[model samples]
Target chain A: MSKQKAVLSEEQIKTRRGRSVALAVTLGVLVAMFYVITIVKLGPGIMDRPL
Target chain B: MTMLEQTQGLHEDATDLGGRGSVSDYIALLKPRVMSLVVFTAAVGLVMAPGNQHPILSFISILCIAIGGGASGALNMWWDADIDAVMSRTKKRPIPAGKITRQEAFAFGMVLSFGSVLTLGLVANWVAAGLLAFTIFFYVVIYTMWLKRSTPQNIVIGGAAGALPPMVGWAAVTGDVTLVSIALFMITFTWTPPHFWALALVKNGDYQAAGVPMLPVVAGETATRHQIVLYSLLLLPVGMAPYFLGFASVFYGVGSAVLGLVFLGYAIRVWRVREGDAAKKTAMSLFKFSLFYLMLIFAGLLAENMIGLV
Candidate 1:
């Protein structure tokens, strides 16, 4: 069987890329902020917590 | 335009408002303005709680509360889309505007609600999670679905959902609500009637068109204005309960007292003046001041607690 090529409209591709980037950035920020706050709040013994 | 006709334009875009949904549309569905108040009050609740929480947990708790608030707003928008479409004020909302499908908004709200509650449960305690869940149910199912269209006393009773955020925040930090948190809830609870009624007085037609039984629509402006004065008078003492209970400093008490009088003054203006543009203008004034009234009162509490002035 012939393989079907992936086809997407330019606008669709752009939207997909934009949404992916936004979601990735949001998740990254949340994770980073959580860790940063954990360090700030927990202080030098941050690693000692059950986290 | 008639209510049905007003919705025709949004309906024509069956493809939906502005072509397609974007991140911003989702944000709008969450009612960012409302969520800001929720976040601020919740933060104030967390701060005023008796003990210190780990800062990370505190951040997570606030985030979860914000998510819960946003989720509830989305659900309200989802269910209220039909009424919303008919109203000029809400005609451009995600579902009504035709940008997001009702099904999409409902699913989005469901996911966020469950995610927020589960995250809060995992990261903090179940008490706060339970409160958050109940808040979503109260606002979405009880307030929006049951009370909004059926009764003139809708905002009076439904106001409980909006007033619960501080208690949620207090629970998040302390794992239990105390007398002080109850006092905080009371402040917002009492404040809601006048705040919403002021807007209802201004936009009575929208509610009438939507078949929503807002007090101003059902009771006539005169009666609704009377109710505003009554609630404002009630707020006089409830606003100062924090100070009287020794949770706030005398300075904050004086500030709250001053704010209460100013709020009462605006409500009294709406009560006594009813013959001209001044009537709507006075309602608008009370509406505007009530927004600042809550922000300033809550901010004062936050400052007093953070500074240990109480």
Candidate 2:
């Protein structure tokens, strides 16, 4: 037997899209924040360390 | 099926399939107004701390503190949805208004709480993270779940959670709690009762209907008014502690004194006016003035520190 898919209405689609965008923006900001913090914490000698 | 029946079925199915809330609804769950006060106070604390901190780290610390504060608000809303539904002021909140489920709020709160605390620990220090975790737990478990429904002294104890952000911010910088930070904590702690009790006086009926046991509901309006006066009096010296402790300049000292006096004047009006619209107006005036009083007090500290007047 095949299963049917649920179709979303316009309002539902808008809400889902808004939430997706918000989540994406929030995650992107978090990533950027972490990167900046890492660079700040490590200081100018960050890349000078031995492998 | 008839045309009307077919349309109704489609409508129902659409509603059921649709997402329950928008991004603004989720933001509403965070109590952004309360979060703003948290950010301001925490930023003051971070700036007032003794050590020199990187600007980027300080910004991250304030952001984490704000997110933690917002998480606590979401958790509080989850626990208080029932009472929130009954209260006129809170009936339109996300959970009570059916824009979000309690389980979803709980999950959102938990995620933000953990994420914020973990990030602060990694970027700042564990002391700040530990305080943030404790603050979330205190507000959610101790205040919302336990004290709020149980006693008239609910906000009195719960105020500690609201008062902890400055200490958390200070800890983020110094990695230790100190006397100056404790002074900031004391000012907010003492200010909470009068600030909240003023509103509680006006919203006594809402608390009574919601069965929340606010001071006005449990101990009567006159008693609550007296408590407001008492707390306002206590706020005077507590607000000036930074100046007395030699961390703030004489200007901050004088400003805090003047603000505290004005706060007391408002509280006196609340105590003197005892009936009808005048009474409510007086109480509301005190409530509004209380917010101004706190902002000025913290702003004075921030200004003093920034101008190197401390």
Candidate 3:
């Protein structure tokens, strides 16, 4: 027995690509936002954290 | 395969997958207009709070509040898709237009809701996050699901959810609610009825057809108009409460009084005109003016606060 695979049309593929890029951009922004927020929360004493 | 055959195959695959919405359609789920007002009021509240917040944290707090408000809006569209399909104003919304499914909207709303609340907690404080969570819950469950269809006083009570943003902003700064924040809350709270009832007057038929018990639909236009005037009158003092409470300056007080008077005048026009196109035009005018009234009131407070800071 052969397994059936889902196939996407050209338009669907394009849309999928668009969604992926948007998600990636959003995640990147979130990462940057968290980093900045973390630094802001830590203040000038951030380097004083014990390793 | 020939070009035509390949195209046909692609079409078949696309059909099988269903209609995929564009990014804009997803953004539409957030109700950006309402989010803007939320952002404005929340920012005002943050600025008006006694303590100083770092500009970056303040920006992040506003961002999170806006996202939380948008998340509630998405959840509202998800729940109200049925009625949204029937109403002229809402029929073109992403869900009703079949651009997005309910499940997708629900997931989007939930993700943003949790993300915003958690992020706000991590950055600001738990009190603000807790308020945001409550706001989302109140808007989604208490207002949209329960009160909206069941009562004409839906927006009256549910208006609390909208009124909470400023309080949330205040909490983010002070870590506790205070009388000044409550004064800010009261302004928006008192303003909501007249603002919404005015729109309800014009959209009576839409609400009727959609079976949503808007004030005009449930209690008739006369009562709604009367309520609008009454609320508008009540709003004058409430709107000026910040100034009276010593939080805002005389500029805000005078501005709020003038705007409140104009808002009342519109409401009176809405009350007097009760037939045909003239009625709708008056109602629409009031509705439009209501937006500016609220925006200007908040802007005045925000401006005063900024001046005080300087």
Candidate 4:
């Protein structure tokens, strides 16, 4: 059903490809950053091994 | 169709905010079977801990553990999306199959990770919450991103995070660590290689194709099987530790002995066969039995605690 939709021009295709790639890369970076910050913040508390 | 038409389709997908995909797709991304084992083992740890948590707090604590486990799965799926797309078994996962956007998965994982950790700290104790947070980070960043591609020992080290649930449960109750809880952690730690290597043996090609650096991919099948036997033997002694240490009763002792023996028998058969139909059959059988072995050992702990018939 969705496949029956009208197609776009060459310039539109190029722009769309660029946008999705950008979105994916942005998400990847954000998630990685979130974990890194969380770890750095929580490291002292979590990694405190009893001497 | 022109290149323009293809690009437009892409834009439509990107902009289609109203088109929420199937709920089943998101559930598939959680890797429910893996989550189930995490929940069960963590629960056993909580239940068998030396002290008791208030019922409401205990419920919240376990809920956090489950969510934390799911969060780890989500992040793992997110990072391994490329390889997941290539492998047949995992190709249908949410991100790989395009059932859910990568952005959505990342968001889901982050929210759950933060919520579970914060809630655990408030409802249980900071120690347990802290451990849960570290487990999520280690699995997602250290193991999934780094060791997985770099070395064959990925699972060996990564398995630590997997093994910590019970310790977290124990910590939730007592607000501190103990020898007993660490021993529980060690049991799962030792069991992981044999448990995973068996699957790696069966799915060697998948790892090879994905360049996963799995033990069976880097080490030969013979070596992997031998290691499985070694870990199985070591686990036998470790499995019986609770009984010997007076942490559990004779029922647990009997159950551990039987389960460990069966696990050893399969591992030995896998080691001896060396190749062909017989080897594959043994490897797969060992893989299936390994799950039962883990569950039974923990179940025995719960039963002994409940019955009080030491």
Candidate 5:
């Protein structure tokens, strides 16, 4: 049987997989940053004891 | 003209009427139904959050999220024009129909994306801003480009993009990701497969012709039916998370459970029907009810918050 040829470079393969997860992580961080700042500002007011 | 030429002439004439790339058609490219769901969920998240926002800012925040969601939808449609042209279900979309050029769609999407992100960051908070930016990027780059053509698992993973709106709305209010907001995200994420698979069951031929590796095409009808049932089952408990978290009330709990059961029953019917016109009807019914189910769950939460019962 003929041997199978590998067509894509390892770098190319890595980039292909890296792009999706990287994008997800990058967005996750952006969302997380917004989350922290908003919490810091609104936390006190929301948790305040109502008169 | 020869017979072939006459047929070709008729085909061209048919395409002319079918290919209306008008201004109204371009707006329809934004997937308004999906955008409406994003807007509604984001609204519920904002209203449910504990802090009191100035009504104007709240409106601005929700509007920004809606615009950001629309921007993602536009970019998705723009990039997927080639694939859209191949799929009968999507062939009438603006870019695919030649109503809007790819470049024009790209520009519109980028402008809206940037404007929405910056505006939300300025008016609402950095958290909302960041979520907006990531959401745009996720849908455009990850879901539209990377996932759609590459895998049968596209909708499952890319469901995260659609689930971000409520989290963005929550961030707008609380400026932090909390258990409650994440739970809201999870509910949508879990519900997505069941909702989409129902539609996919009805549109299997379109997906097959388009060469998209949708679950129904890649996995076949039997697996698609089974997975729909499984996800609908999982969705039942997740739909009630807001009530358990004290972000909603008993009304929401009861409403969500009843809706979840109804959804599950439809999924079960779709699974049992299997094939033929009956199966198609079952899938179509599930598809319609799933939309109402999602809307009702969010509406129940909004009503609970309005009454100060959360």
Candidate 6:
């Protein structure tokens, strides 16, 4: 959540963008890891299903 | 945030006023440095186990163990924020520095604890998950809250939590612990006193002010140094246990012996040199070398396993 603040300077805006990018990248990597593990663990049974 | 702003924020937090923090602050609550060590030791246990484990399950199990370790750190920070604020070494922690609120830190830790434990149980076996749960409980409740300030032997007993990762990792793969894993646990368990007492000797003033009963604070520095030397002596054999047990090769055996000797030498320096500046320097030297000693021993085990595979 954004804190209440005055108008940002150019440097402040750049720093904010950097922080957001880092957070997004980290979360994305974690999500992708879980996704790969989920597919690898469960996909084979579903692929060979008869029902 | 600026220092002035952070100070104001901490003051507000102390008075039950409101403040805000960022994702990095939340992450810092997990103590990533300690988490890395836990993850490494746990991964070593899993990989070296002579049992089959699916790659996906092993990854998940290790990840869950790391998260559990991180959760313990967060819970520890939450409970010890008071002492942390007073201690120079820990005053800049996320909570005390006003980067995170106490309630938020505690909530974050609780969520991670339950999530990691339950997910590990579902993905791996209940045995591994149960060990993770116990490790967290031991670190948070048994070590951080109960024993930390109550007794001088706090780190001695609290070391169990730090030492559990390997057992958890081994159990994840084999679904049962073996003597090898127990030996790994013991190495870390005994290694704790010297590793921590070295730092305790340096930070006696902080422990004194925080009212934490560190061995140096309660037993005096000379006594603490004697204990460090004793523990270092014990560590020499324990460090070589993997090779002696035939799990690791002779390369590890030789490396561990040299490293253990160096470790003992540092502790001996701390014990023998009892002057003013010289004593502090030796204590700090032992403190720094202890980190390297632990890292190298574990790395030696990993390398031996890899060489065997080759």
Sorted on TM-score, best first, the list reads 2, 3, 1, 6, 4, 5
lDDT of 1 by residue, B1-310 (tens): 6676665444444444232566788889899999999999999999888787877788888999999999999999888888898888998898887667777788889999998998888667899999999999999999999999899999999999999999999999778978999999999999999999999988888899888999878889889988999999999999999999998999999999999999999999899989778889999999999999999999999998888897
RMSD of each: 3.7, 5.5, 6.4, 10.5, 13.9, 4.5
For model 3, the stretches where C-alpha displacement exceeds 4 angstroms are B1-19
- Of the true interface contacts, each candidate retains a share of 0.10, 0.85, 0.45, 0.00, 0.00, 0.10
Which candidate comes out best when scored by TM-score?
A: 2
- TM-scores, all candidates, are 0.89, 0.94, 0.93, 0.81, 0.80, 0.87
Q: Write the per-residue lDDT of candidate 2 for residues B1-310, one digit (tens) a residue.
A: 5322332222123244336789999999999999999999999989988888899999999999999999999999888887787788998998778777777788899999999999999989999999999999999999999999999999999999999999999999999999999999999999999999999999998888788899999899999989999999999999999989999999988999999999999999999999999999999999999999999999889988898886
Candidate 1 positional error at B168, Å: 0.7
In model 3, residue pairs whose N, Cα or C atoms come closer than 3 Å (at least 3 residues apart or on different chains), thus clashing, are: none
Report lDDT per candidate: 0.89, 0.91, 0.88, 0.82, 0.81, 0.85
Could you tell me how far off, in angstroms, the CA of residue B9 lies in candidate 2 after the best superposition? Answer: 24
Which rank order by lDDT, best down to worst? 2, 1, 3, 6, 4, 5
Model 2's CAPRI class is high
TM-score of chain B of each: 0.95, 0.94, 0.93, 0.93, 0.91, 0.93
Prediction 3 TM-score vs. true: 0.93
DockQ of all models, two decimals each: 0.23, 0.80, 0.52, 0.03, 0.02, 0.22
Model 6 segments more than 4 A misplaced? A1-34, A48-51, B1-19
In order of listing, the candidates' clash counts read 3, 0, 0, 5, 6, 0
Cα deviation at B116, candidate 2, in Å, is 0.4
Which wins on TM-score, candidate 3 or candidate 6? 3
Sequence-dependent TM-score of model 1: 0.89
Pick the winner on DockQ between candidates 5 and 6. 6
- In model 2, pairs of residues that clash are none
Give the interface RMSD of each candidate. Answer: 4.3, 1.0, 1.9, 11.3, 13.3, 4.3
